[model samples]
Target chain A: MRRFAALVRRDLRLSLRAGTDATTAVMFFVVTVALFPLAIGPESTVLARIAAGVIWVAALLASLLSLERLFANDYEDGGLDLLALSPLPLEAAALAKVAAHWLVTGVPLILAAPVLALLLDMPAGGFAVLMASLALGTPSLSLIGAAGAALTLGARRGGVLLSLLVLPLFVPVLIFGAGAIDAALHGVAARPHLLLLGGFLAAALPLAPIAAAAAIRQALS
Target chain B: MALPDRMAYLTVAMHRFANPARFQRIATAILPWSAGLTVLLLAAGLYLGLVASPADYQQGDTVRIMYIHVPSAWMALFIYANMALASAVGFVWRHPLADLFCRAVAPVGAGFTAVCLITGSLWGEPMWGTWWVWDARLTSVLILFFLYLGYIALVNAFDDPVRGLKAGAILVLVGVVNLPIIKFSVDWWNTLHQPASVSRLGRPALDPAMLTPLMVMAAAFMAYFVTLALLRTRAELLNRRIQVLQMARGAS
Candidate 1:
């Protein structure tokens, strides 16, 4: 247990020291959302109509910006073999890496989403649901992206291939996350959509790590 | 023989042909039969589907596209399920044939999915009055196509063949589990495709005249899939042999 915490702390410390993942993700999130209004039209009504989709998609893409770094450095430097051979189970280590990734990139994107939502003229009533859905949705993105990152650990053109592998899998999270906010904006209950997002997170939590660990093991072997 | 003994006997019989050489002989024997069946069934299926089947009162001739569209869609899903099963087998038993089968079948599955999509679009422009819609089933099938592409790309991405196959097996398994969640979430978000499961319990609520062509086309598609899969696996096996020979010559 201590080792698990230490591993997560090590990853967090690495990211903080690099000072890139969180900043780049948040900056990417804001910039991408900003572009939507410019491209679609600056009309507040049009912006408001697409606010949820724009925010969710931008956050999803922003999360992707830093995903390749999740295990690439570790795998390249032989640290992944140590992790595999350590007392901690590979699956637990996989979870730790993904958790650290979520804390670093996913949370920042979530935090930036509300401000971008406002910039895009999202209605006031949708803010709470938007935050809640992001809270539930972004972790699923991290979990899913971790597997993609691990699968592409040593591949040529790994980043582009990672997105190709990961985005179709991201469709559900995008749907439910955007749907929940859309429900709230339309004065409907967001509960069902939020619950489904939670369900996706639950399914992804255990399964994605196993897949990531398997891919890591495959890479090392 | 006792049931357990009979099962054991069957296992030995199958594993005896697990050797690439023995598998080749069997594949060669089955190839001609499958190819013949594919040609005969396809010819019969096309005649029935394109010429004999009644035009829908509403759809006219465009109803005929479903004959190609639905069967390819069925094969696309079927081959995915088959690959998932093969991956699990390869993972658990470390069977070379299972990995080879996955590599062999992915392109075939992707081809079926492509046909399903294009044929679907052709049908939709006439029926749904758009070339496409973000409907639940349409989106799910499109995702399935992407999954096939991802698997094939990952399987070929590595310098080491074994590593690539192992990575792809993990992906295939992951995808099979996620397939339902994706299907359900999209259904919840919006449903434009017909709920198809409701029709599976009995004969699919089609006129017997129309159902025959659909069934024959489905059979033809299955035979075509079997023939192609066998041929591809044989090619993969032969390619591996050539690689082994080349490496041996270089080392010598």
Candidate 2:
């Protein structure tokens, strides 16, 4: 457990020191969300109606933008080979990385979403639901993105391939996350949608790391 | 023979065909049969589906689109399941041909999925009064189509073919979780798409006239997949041989 925490701290420190990945991702999220009003026209009704979908889709793409660095950096510098030889299991190491990624990327995106939601004039009732949905949903995105990053570790055009590999998997999260806000907008209880997101997170939490670990091992081999 | 001996014998039998040389011999022998079956079934199916079957009471000739759409949809799911199973076998057992089979199946599966989507859209325009709907079934199938494209793209992205194969295999396994969701999305979500008419309790609700042609067309598509897979796997094996020979010549 201590080792896991240390690994997480190390990754967090590394990402913070580099100071580009998380910031770029959040900026991309904001810029992507900002573009919707321009593209769809500056009408409040139009923006409010599609705000959840626009925010969720932009966040999904933003999360994907930084995923290439998730394992490629370690794989390139021989750090991954050493990590595979470490006392900590590779699966736990993967989980630590995913946790750190979510901390830097997912949390910031979640924080920024409500602020951007205002640009779209989202209803006041949707703020809590959107935040809750992102809170529950973004971890799965990081977890699944880790597997995608691991799988594409040594591939050519990895950024493009990663999007292809990960985006379809992102559909369920997008559906439930955006669905929750849609339900709130229509005065329906968003509980079911939120719970479904939670369920996806629960299932993805343990399973994704194992898959990622296997892919990392394959890449190192 | 005892259980362990029997298992050993079975493994040997399986491994015999795992060799590329041996697989080529067998594939050549069966290719003609599969090709013949494919042509025969397709001819018979087209005849039955396009000519023999009567038009739907409500849909008129447009119902014939279901003949192509349904079978292509079935093949899309079938090929994905097969690909996933092959990946699992390759990952656990390291079967030499499993990865080859996976690479061979992906594009053909994608083609079938594309056909399914295009025909489905054509059918939907006349019936549903739109080119597309965000209903559960259509959305899930669209996702399946993307999964096929992803698998194909991943499998070819690495300069090291072996690494690409292994990576693609891992992805195949990860994507298997979506299969069940796609299968059941209609039941779980209240959507515009109709629920399962073929695989429900007891007998299928489809009329006999429609059902017969559908079955024939499905058989044709299955035969087509088998024929193409064998041919493609053979080509892949030959390509690998050429790569090995080129490396050997370069070293010399």
Which candidate leads the pack in DockQ? 2
Model 2 regions more than 4 Å off: B1-13
Which pairs of residues have clashing backbones in candidate 1? none
Q: Could you give the TM-score of chain B for each candidate, in order?
A: 0.90, 0.95
Cα displacement (angstroms), candidate 1, residue A175, comes to: 0.7
Per-residue lDDT of B122-211 in model 2, one digit per residue for the tens?
A: 999999999999888898889998988998899899998989989999999999988898789889988887888888667999998999
Q: Candidate 1 DockQ category?
A: medium
Please provide, for model 1 over A135-215, each residue's C-alpha lDDT reduced to its tens digit, 9 standing for 90 to 100. 999999999999999998888789888998999889889988999999999999999999999999999999999999989
What DockQ, between 0 and 1, does each candidate earn? 0.75, 0.91
lDDT value, residue A127 of candidate 1: 92
TM-score of model 2 vs. true structure: 0.97
- The segments of candidate 1 whose C-alpha lies over 4 angstroms from its true place after superposition are B1-14, B181-190, B197-199
DockQ, candidate 1, vs. native dimer = 0.75
lDDT of 2 by residue, A91-184 (tens): 9999999999999999999999989998899998999999999999999999999999999998899999999999999999999999999999
Model 1 CA lDDT for position A1: 89
Number of clashes recorded per candidate: 0, 0
